[model samples]
Target: MRIVEGIGIAVLVLLAALAVLFLRRLVIARQGGTIELGVRLSTMVPGRGWSAGLARFAGDELRWYRIFSFWPGPRRVLTRRGLAVERRRTPDAAELLVLPPDWVIVRCINRQAPVEIAMAERALTGFLSWVEAAPPGESTPETRPYRYKTG
Candidate 1:
């Protein structure tokens, strides 16, 4: 009986250790990344389907800090102050300026505050389309100024 009890305790300890390791990995993955201006639209709604698709696309297209969560609301607007602070902290990190395919913005605030801001899908689509359509030579005014057309 003592041998069985000892084995059970050992198994519990192993499981607990594994859980801790997994959580650590999650935190490390969430922290340490810069935010950039970029947008993405999804055909699916804002839930598991959209999240999965976004994850797959991010993995394939660019290296990003894990998407904490998305917010769905009546309007679509990225908080200037929130993003500004994040950018200031991690200048090198790419900020995902997303107008979610759905009416939502995935937001992960300090691990404890995870939310989905709502917005219009059409609005997000239009914004993303514009960004994609912009000519390579044309510069966005947000971060750069135009000099002249070289080509």
Candidate 2:
């Protein structure tokens, strides 16, 4: 009977410890500004019924320029002129555009610059880091593919 009581107490302690750890993880993730893609939109409202379905499909098709580390963080929307002179111009001079969450339009400023490669690599790496740092029991997508539409 004593042994049973001790075992129960031990189990309760272990459960409490686990709960603390789980809460700690959530707090850290929130503080770190880590968020999963497709989970929330920082800008445009979600469409209704059929439109929402189409929007989802559109989202699936639109190529992700980058997976930003923080949601709704500072971003730059490059213009054609800006892109053309990206390599030549100082990084500080470059204007960053903070886009609406639902904005799928990606315009390249420079036809010859390495922006696409750089952006893609950064996004991929950021996503991998997010996955690695994610806490146990927190759900994440199994895979992400680069989807883009060409005009």
Candidate 3:
């Protein structure tokens, strides 16, 4: 049918455009010698699991940009305030589907909302240090690492 053919053509065109857009984002995020590491991020929703992508630590905020997204800027910016590290866990079937092998998940609360993100162990250490480091003479509850520890 003409209508079916038209629809298929439209879908193919859209996929092509999306592919180009995402590739542009990938190139842009890696510019200026920035360290863009692969990471998986997700909310605490039961059915909704992690979305694997790239993360670049830019100053006080951790910039989260999805891998397949067309947006040039980060979709989410995680700050130290209201950020709490929950626990580490091995990826389940759903997460394993997205994350890379040997990578571990670090669950945390981002701005009062529960979030889980996965990265390499070395990157995890860097993230913890980044979250714990505080500015001179301005110590807030968010800067304290011990607050995130659970019994």
Counting clashing residue pairs in each candidate, in order, gives 20, 11, 0
**Which regions in candidate 2 have their CA more than 4 angstroms from the true location?**
35-151
Kindly provide the TM-score of model 3 when superposed on the true structure, using C-alpha atoms. Answer: 0.68
Worst 10 residues of 2 by lDDT: 48-57
Residue 50 lDDT in model 3?
Answer: 61
Task: Give candidate 1's error at residue 46 in angstroms.
Answer: 49
lDDT of 1 by residue, 18-49 (tens): 77655644553454322322333342443322
TM-score of each: 0.23, 0.26, 0.68
Between candidates 2 and 3, the one scoring higher on TM-score is 3
Cα error, residue 134 of model 1, in Å, equals 27
Model 3, C-alpha of 20: deviation from truth (Å): 2.4
Off by over 4 Å in 1: 32-151
Candidate 3 clash pair list: none
Q: lDDT per model, in order?
A: 0.32, 0.30, 0.66
